[model samples]
Target: MNFSVGPPGLIIAAPRSGAGKTTVTLGLLRALRRQGGAVQPFKCGPDYIDPAFHEIAAGRPSFNLDSWAMGEELIATLATEASAGATISIAEGVMGLFDGAAARGRSGTGATADLAALLGWPVVLVLDVAGQTETAAAVALGCARYRDDVDIAGVILNRVASQRHFSLVAPAFDRINMRIFGAILREDRLALPERHLGLVQAGEIPAIDQRLDALADIIAAAIDLDAIGQSARPAKAAIAIREAHSDGARSRLQPPGQRIALAQDRAFSFMYPHVLRQWRHAGAEIVPFSPLADDPPDATADAVWLPGGYPELHAGALASAHSFREGLQKLARRSIPIHGECGGHMVLGRGLEDADGNRHEMTGLLGLETSFAKRRLHLGYRRARLRIACALGAKGTEVLGHEFHYASTVSTSDDPLVDCWDAAGAEVPEQGARQGSTTGTFFHVIDRIAI
Candidate 1:
């Protein structure tokens, strides 16, 4: 058997969170696709939402490359596997180029810079030139000089007011010896809709294709597509990926069972693509059902997984889904392994309070009650050691994951699932709840502890 080399790639990053990284990434993906290029898209951290939009623009599934939660070998293997046969790959950065968790992982800090340095890819910073022109070049120069290992190859000016604004910004970069990739004039029409978590799900947008096409047209006309394509370098890991197969470097999460029942649809759509891909590669079969559609878990399945999504938004509909609730209860009674993450954990509880303070009955599999009426943000990277054996892993197993939600726990009487610690290595309270063979947690698992 022969292995193929992965595609050349680059990272699209920014100086801060709201600096048009997503806009530039989506537009670039669509623009490259429109130019008849096979583009593979990727996200830098543990983001579920942006990858959905990436898939739409790139016409392929986008995978998360979390340096903190995942080991270097896993990241390299996944990246190489996902980029096979594509002409180029584009990874959208997280908060900022250098922003990351306080603690480092197996590699460097989980920053976009770590990924760029690891993959030998160049970073194209997207600068929001709203209020300043030459000052933008200063920011780029500082980022380029801040780290020796990571390369800041070029800069893209977003929100340029006019030709005068572009003229001022372009020459500043030339003076600093920084490459100017393109200048995007201010366009309110290109902004994607947003909700609490982030942008509204791509499927929710009725004119998603039309919007993406518009973005492609704008980006194609403004940016230098050929130059951007030429700048990409083949992934350094791609050359050594074949060795990963012989070294026992593979997915840390074991298949829950031979046949798995998965909750899907808009309400439960936060499942990771790589997790499912690993399970399938390990010979596990996934059968999907919709709780919002009153569909029950497949009875033939030996395990059931309910991933995170906007369950709070559809509390009333979920409460009224008698068949779905009954099926879950039946599965639990039969001793089948069942696990829930974030929103799914909320639905597995005794009750849920919606944003309007209305209460709705849930499956009552656990003694947990959650309320969105009194929202409190819980966001961070987590390191967890299992306190009780469940679908995720056996007792004493450690896992790396993250939590990002606005729901608070009202009450819980079940045994704790994991002894958890935040990214700073500070021990937090015991998290999640477990009863019988059922387990649930707000933490979304990315990978297990590297052995």
Candidate 2:
């Protein structure tokens, strides 16, 4: 559908992290939504946390506009399409505006500034004016002038110490020919809750709206909401895509099963939004049960899928779910297809040992045991070649995915999960070992091919 609203204004960020970009972005989204403006939210990189807050603010699933992963044209197209009904679109910056993937090179991940220039959207710079006053203006001036292609829309001073600080820094924006969007007081509650997997996946937090409301109220009261809304400029052109992957053309149908129960709760929430959307589009009915609540797979389900999440945190609850255990055991006895991802892999194992060396009984579908205490950071991009047939794909099939975990398997079979290839084409060991109808791993599949 063609969007009717004009192009939205995007936020151009700093050259570093911890600059309060996320807070300012979230505040604006909530404030706009409260003001009755149709606002669509977009993030500039591959982040799961911020998008959760964005979805809360916009009341719709917000998509990522990654310059590196998805390309600039696609980013522009997503912005244009998303902006169709909203009065203004807000694309939050990543680490920093001018910071690219590398220190200096063409191969570095696309930076926030690169995306701003590509979309022809004006940037409202959010500067942390903590210790210095006029120097803050110099930083804003430098970011604005560093690249002529990017237009500096306005300046929003964050973490201002006092009224004197605002008075000291407000003129710096005028001298540099930049508009002052608004200033925000330092607030602690506005800080979003976070865990290892990123801002505590939205599904994990039930009171997310309360947090968004607090942020919106603060931003609406302190910042000039109307002027900031006006600061958004029409994107010169829609986000475009030059090269498109052929995953949509090659459809992989999810095999039919009477009852497909998905493990969903705080412990199993790291699912790709598109995957579920596509599954429903492909005529698959999904039933959800909670491991955190000690609920097992419904007896009617013929297949069970456990996505990744913080299984280590709820070790006690998961270990004690009697109904969940008995229900899963019943499914296993019936030869059901059971698949697990990072956290799911741990739960299906023989046992889970917490950081304090406490072991908890799990589903024991596979002869694997995971430990968070004996952990090592495993972060990387992966390409996999499946050796056996499963519910999601066929044998000898290829899939692209990523791995982000800090858990190790204490007792596992020698057989590997699937053959993995790194970005450099070097082969790593198998991601996880599989036996029978159950499959699992530490890797999070990107699903280049539709599943």
The clash count for each model shown is 0, 15
Q: Looking at candidate 1, what is the lDDT of residue 319?
A: 98
lDDT, model 1 = 0.89
Candidate 2: worst 10 consecutive residues by lDDT? 100-109
User: What does candidate 2 score on TM?
Assistant: 0.82
Give the per-residue lDDT digits (tens) of candidate 1, residues 1-451. Answer: 1244378899999999999999999999999998888999999998999999999999999999988888766777677887877899999999989999998965656799999888888899999999997899999999999999888889889999999878877888889898888889999877999999999999999989999999988888889989899888877844355453543354368888999999999999998898898788778999999999999999888999999999988999999999999999899999999999999998999999999999999989989999989878999888899987789887888888889999988889999999999888998764888999999999999888644
Candidate 1: TM-score? 0.97
Writing each residue's lDDT as its tens digit, candidate 2 over 1-451 gives 2322255666647656788888888888888888788887877765667877788887766766554444333344566755677777888888778764433212124578877776777888888888978998899888878889888887888899889889998887778777887888777886767766567676656787887788889888887888877777767644342333433325333433546799888778777654565466556778999977878787888788898888899889998888887888788788888888888888888899998999999888788988988778876556677777775577777766567888887888635657787554568754676767777877766444344
Question: Residue 451: error of model 1 in Å?
Answer: 5.1
Q: What is the Å distance of residue 310 in model 2 from its true position?
A: 1.4
- In Å, residue 301's CA in model 1 sits off its true spot by 0.4
CA-lDDT, candidates in order: 0.89, 0.73
**What is the Å distance of residue 23 in model 2 from its true position?**
1.6
Residue 124's lDDT in candidate 2:
83
